[model samples]
Target: MPHITPCLWFDDQAEEAAQFYVSIFEDARIGAVSHYAEAGQDIHGKPPGSVMTVSFELAGQPFLALNGGPAFRFNQAVSFQVVCESQQEIDTYWEKLSAGGDDAAQQCGWLKDRFGLSWQVVPAELSDLLGGPEPARAQRVMAALLLMKKLDLDALRQAHAGG
Candidate 1:
């Protein structure tokens, strides 16, 4: 068992979320579904045997989702990032993730989901250059990222080298 795991707090629909996630990613599976007991209080108007927690794996990382009432919610402050090697991959993720035409950021990322979860779709090289040691180079890359909805490494490099 992983000593540490990220647990997601959903208003309800924990099982539905788990199923949705597992269906989207390869190498993913739903591990467990804990349903509310007959003696437990009805939550979300669900039946006593309805799921209260769902455990699943995404890209091989274990995550837990709880039907923990409305105590917490997802926001842009914490987002999952998908790094792509080419524009094709970027488009694929963007299309699937932003299905409902949710809000998009100018820097080549968008937030959308069947469940309203936010995601950042970035080019792999952008993370490489932005995290590189050269400050000037990194700044140039950042500038390039600012103008694009998806990162373009060639343009960023050209700008960095002042070409």
Candidate 2:
């Protein structure tokens, strides 16, 4: 199968955004960085040597950050979901990604990062808690989930257990 990579558009912050993401994820790294050329100056409006694209990887998933200007902006329509195994993992990601983010945009384990990118930091066992034969348990867990910003695995488990 052909490998697919997510391309992120930034307003002259491709390199900066890639660096920030690399710093947050343990298995992340910045790869090739391409600069603009004088040929496209009229259309791109960027300096000849300015950064144009930054290739990066987060949690082994390849991504490309493009300095495509401010014509477009990130919204909640697209989001990256981080499945964490523990509350500690969730807390770390939530803290890092939500830093300098809009507080009003945070709800139900979803947050907008400093770069305006939306992220969903959820527990690994979320499916199990919200699924299964017991509809009441799942409903309770869903109710609990709807009330929080960053997800609490313990609270979800408690709700699933009818506590």
C-alpha lDDT score of every prediction, in listed order:
0.73, 0.96
Over 42-133, each residue of candidate 1 has an lDDT whose tens digit, in order, gives 43565687678888988878889888877687776777887777877877777766665455443456555666576788777766677766
| lDDT (10s digit) by residue, model 2, range 20-134 | 9999999999999999999969999999999999999999899999999999999999999999999999999999999998889999999999899999999999999999999
Per-candidate TM equals 0.79, 0.98
Clashes of 2: 0
Off by over 4 Å in 1: 42-46, 104-110, 152-163
Model 2 poorest ten-residue lDDT run = 33-42
> Clashes in model 2: which pairs?
none
Off by over 4 Å in 2: none
Error of 2 at 149 (Å): 0.4
